[model samples]
Target: MRLEAVGRRYRARGPWVLRGIDLDVPEGALLRVEGGNGSGKSTLLRLLAGIDVPTTGRITGRPRTAYVPERFAATLPFDAAGYLVHMGRVHGLCGRQAAARTEEWLERFGITGFAGTALDRLSKGTAQKVAVAQALLAEPELLVLDEAWAGLDTAARALLDEAVTERVAAGGTAVYVDHDPRRLAEAVPRRHRVAAGRLTDGPGGADEMARVVIEAEGTGEPPAALPPHSWTAGPAAGAPGLLRIRVPADRADAALRALLDADPPWHIRAVRSTGGTSPSGAVR
Candidate 1:
């Protein structure tokens, strides 16, 4: 699957959200899209999924690509199992085959009880699990996810992580968006960031280690108030609302914990680290 020079603009918007984005995704590959909010990562995924057309550029790939967005689309009024079966049928599975596969995915995602319950009645997280199941039921050649990990707890995250790994091992390609660099690194994924209408590997490609860069932003916040060297105050290009902190290759984990414990208003929107050994195995 490939998207070359892809771009999108909403209703004559002044700036392009996705500009000249290009990517080549091969079978069995998992690519993580990392970027700050409004950076157009989700838009790029949507375009690739064929949910929306690109204003410029071209995408070439098999039609079996599937996408799971941040907000799971509401299922028609039906029990969870019914919905799964419906989705499977849409993917071309016959009755018995669809039922068997739905059962397997429901258990795999740990949402079995939801089988008899209405999808709308389930919690947000539970609903997402079904959406994930729907996406995987077809076992598409290419899977695209947008912020799929945001609301999930540790266990759920781990489950999906394993599933994604297994899928790739079975010759499937995936495009996923999430905030966890450590998870992405664990998968040995190819990482890219969408910024200023372009996508780049940004300091690391497929072989580099994962790095997390946290920045403090907001008015009247002291950059020096945080740990020295590990956190610094600076302007991030095209991001005036950000105070950048470039985590050293050796200090990422501890630095991240320190920042989390500190509970600063600033949050890590994207990771800019390549891989290296970290101090005390913290975040290197």
Candidate 2:
């Protein structure tokens, strides 16, 4: 998908929140966007997700997308499961399919115990899980996560990390905005920023490593099939017995396969792009 000279503003002559924003979000791309408060980062994401339209110029080639806004109201009338099932049907799934996926995602996010609760009554973390689950229900071609992990618990956050990797591995695009610099410090993703109502290139942070971080918890030696420089393992953060594997992006597929196909399956926790410059403007 591509954007050409896109611009957006509130009124006929109001200050533009975004202008001359040209972007190329290719298939299978993992992109991270960074910017300061009020720098139009959210606006750019909104445009990309089709929540809003450009006031001037053109945007084309948009793909099937799913977006998780930074803040989602939990006061909706429907209960958690009902809302997800309704949204699933809206996204074209049959009632049975929707119910099954809803139950599956709730389980994945550790929220099945609360699936029947009213949305407004659930904890903030549970609400966030619902939001994320709704977005992932359809396996959209384009995934837009705007601070989607803010209220998640440790396991749920790790689940989201895994979800993004699976999407990219399947030749889908996933764009995300997060305050934490280390959110995906292992997946060498393309980085950009919003500044002065425009998307520009500048220094965000250190973008030297082109590696993917794979997490698994088990006892095993690094696979011999992987290039010497393509993989390394260590204890993953926040979880004992979990191993974090770092590998060159080009070799991630093979490395992941080798690890998963080992004699004893290495339970994969998360995989993400790491080492990026997070600043107002991104630089090569």
Candidate 3:
């Protein structure tokens, strides 16, 4: 997929979220979008997914791309399996195939119990898993995810990483939006920052990237285990209640689990990265 000078504005009076953005994602490559909120990250994903039309420039790609937004789109009363079945049907999958895939993904994400639970009743992480499962069911040529890993636990996050890897290995492409550089460093090898209607490569010079983030679950403490290689610790921005532990790509999972299992309130939230090496002092 290739995007050139892509721009989008919902209203004439409002400022454009994306302006003059140019990007090229080769087949089977993982591309990550990074930026603060309202920085056009979601807008870009929407444009790429063809959910919203752009007011300026053009995007050239397959139209059947699978898009997973930051929020759940299914009705509140629907079960995870039901929602997946509906989505799969829309994507031309047979009833039996949809059911099989739904069951497989739900179990893989460690949410088998959620198969029958209403979307509204499921926890935030579980709902997110359903959303991801639906996207995967389509077997899209291009997978575009917006905050795809937000609110997920460590195990769920690992499942997502593996899913992306599998899809790419099948010659599919992915475009993800995230804010956690550490996760991106581990999952992706390339990074781009969105700002003022523009997109530019940021951090790491690689073509693929990976990143992850672990957050607190109300009253819980952050994880203590750090990623392998070089790691650094410091206060998280605008989050006095937590600390940011940056880890290298090699030991990210171990460091993350150790921290979460330390019996503190920490929970793995999201991961993003440029698939780069973490700084030294990452592990302790």
Candidate 4:
């Protein structure tokens, strides 16, 4: 899917929430959208999900899409299971298939007990699970999550993570926004920041390329041929043998694969963004 100079606003003369945006949402891409509050991140997502249209410019080649909005309306007059089954059907699943998927998701989210319970009667977290399930049941080609992890328990949050990984691995596209910077920080390759009604590539300014920090512990030497433009820090105090490796965000997966595929794999401790740090001693 592609957006060409897309712009959006509530009214014709109202200030633009977003403008001068051009983006290419490739198949199988995992993109992250970031911004401050009232910065049009949600607006851009709604546009991608077809929940809202651009007031100016054009969007073309959108695929089959599903979206979990920031605020899910749990007041729908249907039981949790019934609602999911209906959503599945709307996404082109047959009756039996829809029912089966509904059961599977409810079980996965540990909400099977509430399958027959009315949506309006469920707790906030439970309702959020139902909202997430409705989107994942049909495996839409494009999935948009707007803070869908909020209100979910740790187990359910992990389940959503696995589901998204599966979706992208199966050649689908997923876009999301979350307050937690560490949420899927290791997997997402493309990140765009929305600010002042405009979109900028990467997590920050053009000169400040995003970087991934990998903390690992290894007995022997680090893996051969670590990704280029990467650096390693000597072990820190109180943590002997702890290797802090930093690489450009785009090469993070490659760096990880090399480490994991070594003769004796390195034990990864943590992975996070550098924010904006440029240490010396680049790996050859």
Q: List TM-score per model, in order.
A: 0.70, 0.75, 0.69, 0.74
Clash count for each candidate, listed in order shown: 5, 14, 46, 0
- Give the total clashing residue pairs for model 4: 0
How many Å off is the CA of 258 in candidate 2?
A: 6.9
| Stretch of 10 with least lDDT, candidate 1 | 229-238
Q: Candidate 1, 230: how far from true, in Å? A: 33
lDDT of 4: 0.82
**Best by lDDT, which number?**
4
Tens digit of lDDT per residue, candidate 2, span 1-284? 89999999989989989988888777766788999999988888898899999999888999989999999889999999999999899778899999999999989988888988999999888999999999998888899999999999889999899888666645577889999988775665567888788786544323532446667766767566755433334522335555555555556677678878887868777777644322121111
Ranking by lDDT: 4, 2, 1, 3
RMSD of each: 14.7, 8.4, 12.5, 9.5
Distance from true position, residue 126, model 3, in Å?
A: 1.3
lDDT of 1: 0.70
| Runs of candidate 4 exceeding 4 Å displacement | 204-284
Top TM-score prediction, candidate number: 2
Cα deviation of 146 in candidate 2 (Å)?
0.6
| Candidate 3 structure quality by residue, lDDT tens digits, 1-284 | 67888788889988877888878776655677888877888888888888898798888865468888988855656787898888898888999998988888888888888788888788787889889888997678888988888988888887777677656534467888765666545534467888887888887534223333333332344343443322222331224444443333455566666756776445545443323344223332
* Span of 10 residues, lowest total lDDT, candidate 4: 229-238
